[model samples]
Target chain A: MPGYRSEHIVSSYEEELTQIAQHISRMGGLAEQAVASAVQALLKLDHDLAKQVVAGDKALDALHRGLDEMAVSIIARRQPMASDLRMIVTSIHIASDLERVGDMAKQVARRALQIEGLSLNPRFYNGVKHLSDLILRQLKGALDAYATRNAAEAIAICNGDDEVDALHTSLFRELLTYMMEDPRTISQCTNLLFCAKSLERVGDHATNIAEAAYYLETGKQLSGDVEELQRVQHKI
Target chain B: MPGYRSEHIVSSYEEELTQIAQHISRMGGLAEQAVASAVQALLKLDHDLAKQVVAGDKALDALHRGLDEMAVSIIARRQPMASDLRMIVTSIHIASDLERVGDMAKQVARRALQIEGLSLNPRFYNGVKHLSDLILRQLKGALDAYATRNAAEAIAICNGDDEVDALHTSLFRELLTYMMEDPRTISQCTNLLFCAKSLERVGDHATNIAEAAYYLETGKQLSGDVEELQRVQHKI
Candidate 1:
């Protein structure tokens, strides 16, 4: 009878864990859509779509709050130990990262709204679009790695941050050159610069999630190679 | 004898709580010094100080990790509930914010290094200097509020973020005009623009810590007023 009772308790605990994981996956989906919509809004200069992206961030925030509350409540009730505790804590971390990703998307959308009707250089917009696509891929990869507990994939996504940083530097230089060549392009180029920055930050948040996934799987931090990348990126 | 034993346990628990609070305070002090030093480096073009700020960020990161580990360990071992759990969780949040504050300082320092020989406009430098001063004040106030568990002071700090936003907008406009007026200033002005942005982000982190402080005290999130302020700031 005791064995059966323990099994029942374990099954309930697993159910709660599954629920939290589902919430994180749902939140990730919303963040992905937010980024996609915001970038499309920027590229098309669609004020309405940008507005939608801004509105969509609230849902992501709500989901994050709900997920955090659930995770904390489970911790308080279950008093999970070792790996279970790490998973719960890391869920909170991932939710926070996803929420910030949503905020970055909103930032990009706001920039789009601000620069509405200003014809920017197509090359600059194309560069930012390409960067956003790459970040979105990283975001998805990180989330998938989390779902599958694939630390190798998570580390790969984390390492991919160097590419984003490189692209951001190039975009920054290109924009500065454009503004120097045509002073009239200063305002629009500045807006694009911020857009690129938002995309770069999205990459950072994706990397953060990748790190969280690695920690969740191994119960250890991925420090060495990632710290080296950060040092190199910091020089600029 | 039993009463004495329980009282001793309570005291030990309180001691653990105090230790976590002390770590947070130490981290906050370091972050404040970092921003101040980084800005001074930028103003004086002091390369050594800039490098110091960059190197000092690792200490802040270590403190953040230690605090988080302590907090999570307490949660798992002690299984704190209600306000105690909230306090522990919020400490982790605040530590994360302070660590990011260090990163922003590092970013400002890197910009200082990149524009080492260029002479930027005095007016623009003064504007950035003034903004940094305000943000540092806010950082101090937020930390003080957290130490005291004073929700009122925290809300005040949170409300102060609007001023930083307004100043950032103006500084951004001024820098853009400077770059447009003199193509030769583009590189320097771009660096200054990032400095302003880093300072502005520091303000956001302060506001985040303030919000965490309020939540720790009240066990409730201060969402309504802060969100309203964010909306007003975003309209710009």
Candidate 2:
């Protein structure tokens, strides 16, 4: 009787979990596209493309809200406990971070619309582009960690956020000098600076998601077992 | 015996909810002060004040993270069902937004540190300062809505975010002209722009919290309700 009840319950729960994971993956894909387009819009001064990014952000926002509704329904209907409940709850937090990341992408695109066709130093754009790329990679890695239930990979990604933060600081100072030297470049420089900040924030949200994934896979928190994770992460 | 079990559970849940509310209020107070000091730091170009603002932000960040951990534990241990779960989860989202609001305040302070004794147009600083004030008020109103279980008030506060956005856009355009005209004004103007954007974003995060509160109280989402909130916000 115990075996029968447990089998039926777990099978139904797994079905819903699969559906939820698919939705999250869909949302993540959209977020990545938004970030890339935001950077492209900035470099090209493409207002049309920028507008598209902003408009698409509404969809991301809706997806986040919709996913939360679904997760709540799952919790209510399924009565998830222990690790199962953690997974669903973690999705809710991930949704919030993803929505904010979408907003950041929108902010960058809006700034692009404001300062169009200005010649920025190639190195400057390159730096911002690199930051975006790194953030995108971290986001992908976090999603993979979720799929595989790999807490070690997730913890490693969270620690990588410090690198993103350092890159942001370096880029901020570089942009500051550009505006400091030439008044004409100030508007464009400020916009790009904000764009870099936005990307840095996206990296942070990714780290948050990674942390959530780790919490879901393991009943422990990385914050509590930092030393353990640090040692294990290095070996991995 | 059934009635006694129910009563004991209800009272215990009430006690935890009360504690959560108190902690959020305390965090809100710190957030209000952070925004205020960051603005003052920019207006006065006081690096020491800015440094203090930065330090204060770290504490605010820690408080936000701590509150989130507490809320999570409450939900996990208490196993809040239905609307109770939603409310706790919403708190987690609100804490993250508040933490980022603290980060933006630190960003403003960091900009202040870069510029020494340089004063910009009082009009510009006043606009940003007023915007921050409005956002703080909105955050307070939203939190009240949460504590009191008032959906309409939360909706109203969420709508107030538009005014802040409009002010930021106007300030950005005006500041651009000033920077474009004078090289020496670029650094100060850039800092002012950062403050303005930070205030605008703070308002946005406040609205997000209001939305979460509304969802928790009513268990109904007025999708794209922000549009309507903006229309009714004038009365507030």
Best by TM-score: 1
Fnat for every candidate: 0.76, 0.50
The native-contact fraction of candidate 1 is: 0.76
* CA displacement after TM-score superposition, residue B101 of candidate 1 (Å): 0.4
Per-model TM-score on C-alpha atoms = 0.93, 0.88
What local lDDT does model 1 show for residue B7?
97
Q: For each candidate, what's the DockQ?
A: 0.70, 0.49
Q: Ten residues in a row with the worst lDDT in model 2 chain B?
A: B222-231
State candidate 1's TM-score: 0.93
Tens digit of lDDT per residue, candidate 2, span B1-236?
99999999899889988787787777777877888888888877888989998988868767876776676677667767777778777777777777877887888889888877765667866776677778788878877887788888888776677777887888888888877777777767766777787888888878877887888777777556556565566654
lDDT (tens digit, per residue) of candidate 1 on B45-141: 9999999999999999999878978988888778887678888878888898999999999999999898857766688778888899999999999
List model 2 lDDT by residue over A179-225, tens digit each. Answer: 87876777678878788878998998888888878888876666667
Give the TM-score comparing model 2 with the true structure, all chains together. 0.88
Model 2 alpha-carbon miss at residue A110, Å: 2.4
